[model samples]
Target chain A: MKAVTYQGKKKVEVKEVGDAKLIKRDDMLVRVTSTAICGSDLHIYHGLIPGMYDDYVIGHEPMGIVEETGPDVTRVKKGDRVIIPFNVACGECFFCTNQMESQCDNANDAKDTGGYFGYSETYGGYMGGQAELLRVPFGNFVPFKVPEDAEVEDEKILFLSDILPTAYWGVDNAGVKPGDTVIILGCGPVGLLTQ
Target chain B: MDYRLEHAKRTNHVETYNFEKTHDIDQTLLEATKGGADVVIDCVGLDAKRTAMEKVETALMLQGGSLGAFNTAANVVRKFGTIQVIGVYGLKYNMFPFGHLFERNVQVKMGQAPVIHYMPELFRQIQTGKIDPTDIITHRLHISDAPRAYEIFDNKDESCIKVVLKP
Candidate 1:
């Protein structure tokens, strides 16, 4: 499958890599139809993020058609359209049940932080989505089905995988009250998207 | 106004300021809200405007990133207010004002947004014209142009606010 791989510091190349397939009982294979370059991707591109292995497929925000699903993948089936959120989480974890999927206990490589696609080893080293296909582990928890008949462009909803949601998370976690004069500092994607 | 300030005005009642125009940004913010902004959110994080000393050090490759926005956030948020950070920070921060926050009783909230949790609601808003994310996008290119896209956006050239790669 074709993917974007890290060549070296501040270098990347889109080339052929190994095809992604279902690896676990809850895994699912997604044929990526649309993917976006996120601000965090710049962290990897600029060498700010450490411990990134070369040739790791490097994109976290994407949505696509399900090519195959393992026996345990019940939330979505083959042929369903889905958005693969950046955080790879096990739905049953304490953090997941509390809607803090980013801190899900099961997906971390180290002690506390949860798994993230194409991020460094600090977050679990899940392969990214900037490829022809992706292996979505804990697939049932992170893949949200999108309607086939929806009359919206993929660009409109692609950010849901990261920026847009992160924006909302900022507002929600801040406990922003009605009529509160909030000062959102940055004018970047996440900053701009935050409600 | 940049994309965010403009988009925000249409959806909510808000005022924006360009710190570049003012000598003291924290002071400007303090005076604008009649004391201080009730909630000062740090969206720039590490990319906050750096001072001459910090700029030279960063240019010399002595720093990973700066927490200038965090400092300003702590300064400008009203006493007993909330500070929300949506900006991405690479790692640990130095010279951060921990003492001032304690004295002012300001609460800080920062983290990754639960993307999946908010998707359905934001999707509906986008579909219904309550929010328009596309207003912020300035360029759309093919996936093959990822390198060029990164270069342009990173350099902040051509009025590039955001670039979308079709893959």
Candidate 2:
């Protein structure tokens, strides 16, 4: 499959890589239709994020059709349109049950932190979606089925994967009350969303 | 008004401070606030030039009888006022006039933004069209043009606000 691989600071290339497949019964295979680049991706591109292995796919926010799923993957099936959550968490983990899915103990246990799709070492180094397809682990926990009527605007739905949730988190953390004057420092995608 | 501040004024109530044109930061603050503003929010973060200017503005704002909100660093606000630090600073930063804050009984609040917690509410707002974040996307480019987009974004070009890449 063709995937965008991070080369080094300020360098990236679309290259052929091994096909993604379900390694676990809970895994699901997705054929990506649309993917969006995030500000965090720039951190990897700029080398601000360390421990990114060479030839790793570079994208997390993606929407696609479920091409296949494991027998245990009951949340979605073939031909189902879905949005892949950036974080790949095991719902039974201590953190997952607590709604701290990003910090799930089993997601990126090898990396010493919860794993995330397409993020570098600091995050669990799961492969990302800047590719033709992605192998989603624990697919039932992360893939959110898009409502039939919600497919009207792909961009808006694609954002459901990360930016929208992240922005809302910012507003909530800042304790933005009704009519409260809030000022965001950076007007980046997240900042704009928060505003 | 500082040109940048003047531009921000179109959408927000902003008072510009050009240090090159003014010497008395306190006086400028006095003028901006008739007596003083009830709350002053600093949107400018660690841009050294902006930070320096904001420090002076914040001090003046407090001296002018307003309770200043130093939204940059916790220590930048006047003694006895509140400082709400929202900007993310990459490096370790130092505080100014530590003794003054202690004496004035100033309050400080700062930390990372927990983005995941608010997802449900923010999602509903966006889905309902109450907020359109795409308005800030000033540039749209193909994934192949990511390098150029980075260059434009890092350089702070007036024309570029945000860039979205299509893959």
Most accurate candidate by TM-score? 1
Worst 10 residues of 1 chain A by lDDT: A186-195
Tell me the tens digit of each residue's lDDT in model 1 across A10-102. Answer: 788888788998889999999988887787788788777777888877889888889999998888888988888998889888889988888
What value does the lDDT take at residue A49 in candidate 1?
Answer: 77
Q: All models: lDDT?
A: 0.80, 0.62
Which pairs in model 2 have colliding backbones?
A115-A124
Q: Which segments of model 1 are wrong by more than 4 Å? A: B1-14, B52-64
DockQ of 1: 0.62
On residues B80-164, what C-alpha lDDT tens digit does candidate 2 reach at each position? 4444444333333244445665685655444433233344555566678775555455666665665566667655565565555
Error of 1 at A141 (Å): 1.1
Question: For model 2, how big is the iRMS in angstroms?
Answer: 4.7
How high is the lDDT of residue B144 in model 2? 62
